[model samples]
Target: MTWKTLIVRVTDSCDGTCYGCLWRKNRISGFTLPVTTINDIVSKMKDFSFDESVILCPNPLYNPKISDIILSLKKVARKIYFFIPVNSLSKVRNKRIMESIDELVIVTTTPEDFKVNEENLKIILSQGFTNIALYVAIGSHTINMDNILSLVNMGKEYGLRIRVGEIPYSTALTLDIKSILAKKGYSVGFTYGMLYGYMASMAFIGNYPVTILAKPLTGECRKLFIDPYGRVSKCPLQTSYLRVDKVTSDILRSLIFSECSIGCRRFELIPKIEISLLTPDGKEIPSEVLSLLEVISHVNSLRAACSIMGFSPSTCVEKIRKVEKEVGIKLLISKKGGKEKGATVLTDEARRILEMYREIRDMVSESLYSEKGIMRFKLG
Candidate 1:
């Protein structure tokens, strides 16, 4: 399935001031972009096929031009989701803004913002605005359970959907806690699939809340966040760091699928290595070459093997020659000198050994993922 696309308005020229803001530390100077870039982005999105799209302006209030920028996006996007912090929610004219498109995703970083969020929600609801969602950022350093409960209760009372998200670069919540919270009726929005390695959990506490989980949707390509400055990022939280220009929707789609495919392919190739030598009758091969097996396990290529074995190219060739002499079979030296230059290929014997090793590796990996009571997850 095609993944959703997000056009992020990241050109806000913040003066490097906000506390707890990750971007404050790595702020780049002279990074402003022309307004025409937004037009280019809109043109690209129109050509880019996707299931849905969102306009992510982290602090839209800080930039008055955001409304104009979003107005341009409304022309290209059928449904646009907005995520604005609670502090800036009040400054927004709900009536004029809600008419632009589909959903308003209000984000709250602290419990104090809950009251303000509630007040804003009521105003929006009273105005007959229905497509509204709340995003709560649960920080590891200063998150208060009392505040979380209050926000959840408030969301429940108002019949508004709540999505709980963890702070950037945090993995504090355990799966058990996530499962328990999910059972208790809170919608968790994890940033697990973010570009960086940080993992987060998402649980649904209500019937209609948005749930963002770690895994990508089946049959669908993964989503990517493209910043206003023409930088294509994999996630909103990673917008500052992951900047890839000269990006199209197709390249973004490939990037996501390639990541998943590479992981699966690696696992599949593991069974092709020889775990142990076997007799001619297919009996267990002796463990005499176990040290070599260990060495091979760490070797990704001939160069790597040579490095690990503390052998130069010439030494490696001599070692292979010695092994062939002892085993009475031709040993495959991965490197070959040819007119096309040096090339690497596994000999038939080497291939057999590699295949056996891979089989054993696959067995071990399968055992781990399929361990008793391990929970497989799906996200919407």
Candidate 2:
């Protein structure tokens, strides 16, 4: 089973504006919105049977109420991490917050921030936060190898680990960043942007083994996402809910056990079959002769029946001739090959036998359906 992670956007708004933020596109109405209540969040998390980590991402450090929410989350979350992006103005402060996290992530845009990031790294280290990771966003600007080398060297100096992630909205930059990181023995993590699903699918199929930090849990394992308003979503990217307001253990189990009602188009190709021998004209044929006629209905050609039954085509032809001679009626409608390939059809005599057999099959199915529930049988 695949491990799932949930990233909950605690606030509807952010303090500092980032250039390419996907959440900004889906903003509710105006500026600020109330954060999701702790009770609702915990209730949603408990619906799942399997273990999962939850990451909380608030707008910025400027929100005074964020600390209270973080404290509440720490109580319920199996594991928690913070993503703090550093820009020119607001820097890292409050060592207490850093110490509280399992992992502290710093997001940077440029090589110039390498020095500032290194300085911030010192502050996190000074606070005694051991698990610190850095992310450098390679955007439209040309990234110099020297700057990456400088950041790598700085990470070594501070005993901090570094990870590179592609900037959202730039395909060229994403490819370039991935190539550079691949050369350096690091893989880029995807945040919000185009082709996110494709990237995630590729990661799973390729067996990359890297953690997708904030995705909804699914399959036999019941991982999921909860919005700030307490609405549960399959993933943060989707706004629809598998369930809302209350995600109980019973509700989750019901969803897991329920079979998919969605039907497939292939059911239309299944041909009907029958098992008796009376003609539509009310003429009765012998049971032994009818059995041979029934085989012709299934495979119109003697050759086809022979292939299916693992008997010689000539033997099947002789059996058909013998049955027709006994019944005193035609059983095969032969067609000659030309541009269209040669084929055969069951004669009227054979079709009558098939219709009777189909009636018997339908009766049996109806009995089973009445005795046992439809849910007990697999739907085609």
Candidate 3:
């Protein structure tokens, strides 16, 4: 399977001295990744056909040539995410970095940080950076639900997106966060890894999306990190790395997977297929319509189906009506309430359509999982 993320430490330097710092703990001196080294890495990535998203981690703002570094990395990256501390916002002095990066990921350790950097946050938001977020490092301190809620409320107020990470140490905190968000009318989608006990959950407060992740104990590393010394490794926390010194393609591929075992089945990659149906006249039926029909088939109420699917009742009905008008067939049957409540159900034709759609979807999935089809997802 192909790796989906590439992380580069543009500089191993930072002005702030936070707790649990590996840099200070190891006494590693401040160093900036040179523009020449960055160009070399980008060329190697291009040669390897690495087109995934790149994340400049630790504190890229401390690097003097950050603007040039971002421009060089952008040549091979699908998108560039710059990670910096809340105090490093002052180093963002020009529009060069602002105009290039796809997202500005700000690292904050506590809830009071939102108030401390209120003016700076306003300035950055006003300067044309549309996709910015706050990464709360739960590993840095003993955080509770109140702290998380406070951050969420401030995020809503400032129109900022938020994510909480490093939560594997506390199962109670994870449950509490999900429970509180659910009780407050926020819809949460949660899942945990069976083998490693990794917890990940997602929800949205207004327009901003909230994410929480508990790092897996052991799994297939889908991320490649390039440290300041020009060495590469899949895991970010790995201490040693393999150096790529203008090597051949075969040698480089070997070096990339040298740490990972052969035929390791910790995590498996699967193909994703989008199922779409078209009418005879060429009108496309959205996948949402199929999902709504399926939900209504079980719930027997349009309102209940919409609630489960995160859609407004009126919006869902309008979508179904459009499809029905185009296909020239009624998809749903509605009954008005008398002494009992109103009810809804799919028509016979709708059931047939659902079945046909499922058959087609399964066939497509089976085809894509074949040996020939699996080649498309392999990394070069």
Candidate 4:
């Protein structure tokens, strides 16, 4: 069987925190797949071709050699797509990506950038990116119609497709919002295949909602997730041992025709969640800091948590202490110990803070639907 799409995680090195994502929390420093490994995987796919495309998930910017990776995948894939973050974009990276990629799914926050004015966006779009799309998650709050139109207009101005995503609350995810989205504002017309095909394949392997636990009952899945370590997993979430050391043409082909299904009248859609944290005073705390705090809470050791995020113990100390001062709350209690007796524990206040953070996250996840509608989310 011929595979139409493949999800490749070229690198796990992200420069920023996405707030809702746990993948970037652990591997933020740097790690790129060696060219040899990538080349081997590409050469192995000699027997088949991708009619759709190969999606470079998350951020391709962190991979120094992403342009070359695109070139290699081009031989096997009809097109290439990238998931670009709003804040994480740089001119050089954008230029390189646009040159090599056929389409781009610009992952951005609708509420955050609503009033920011399109000056920067105007300048960036002027640089000329082709076949762009906007991806917004329906988190825990109800989005008003005005903001929804604003997001659609942005995509229209750029002559790009727009996709509004969430874990499916309704069994039949009718394209009701698509009708509103499909109405042209001021751009040329494009087909649904670009947006829907991309959305389906990408969502299939992603982590969100955390509700649906249906693993591929068959030996494989139609799509594959290739990570930076060159491991191939059956699902994008990549849990358990559905991973293989070697990925060949047969391996990828086997995945596409794996005869896998959830064995249900309908499969539950796992909503893609996004969360942002701010102080009661409305000052936004960097998600990276919150992630650090979360790690410390679980491990009960400041140094170990720092190590997990690839940060030095002292650096972590400075970050946490600075937040403590700013928030006027001590998050961690230190224990001076002899040799192995020393440990760090979260204060009661810190535990409360963590619980609150989790509440915000779960709220965003639940924001997948509201009374207004099932298709859009607005975060407060």
The global C-alpha lDDT for each of the candidates, from Candidate 1 onward, is 0.48, 0.45, 0.60, 0.52
Model 4 TM-score? 0.52
The parts of candidate 3 lying over 4 Å away from their true place are 1-3, 17-28, 47-51, 140-143, 167-186, 190-201, 204-208, 214-220, 246-248, 251-380
Best by lDDT: 3
Q: Write the per-residue lDDT of candidate 2 for residues 126-155, one digit (tens) a residue.
A: 766666555444444565656555655655
The reply for model 4, stretches above 4 Å from the true place, is 1-3, 16-19, 23-27, 91-96, 114-119, 140-147, 167-221, 241-247, 260-380
In candidate 4, what are the lDDT values of residues 315-372, reduced to their tens digit?
7788778888887788788878765366788889878876777667545433333344
Q: How close is every model to the real structure, measured as TM-score?
A: 0.52, 0.46, 0.60, 0.52
Error of 4 at 174 (Å): 12
Record all residue pairs in model 4 with backbone atoms less than 3 Å apart, i.e. clashing.
139-367, 140-364, 140-367, 167-271
Clash tally for model 3: 0
The lowest-lDDT stretch of 10 consecutive residues in candidate 2 is 196-205
TM-score result, candidate 2: 0.46
Ranking by TM-score: 3, 4, 1, 2
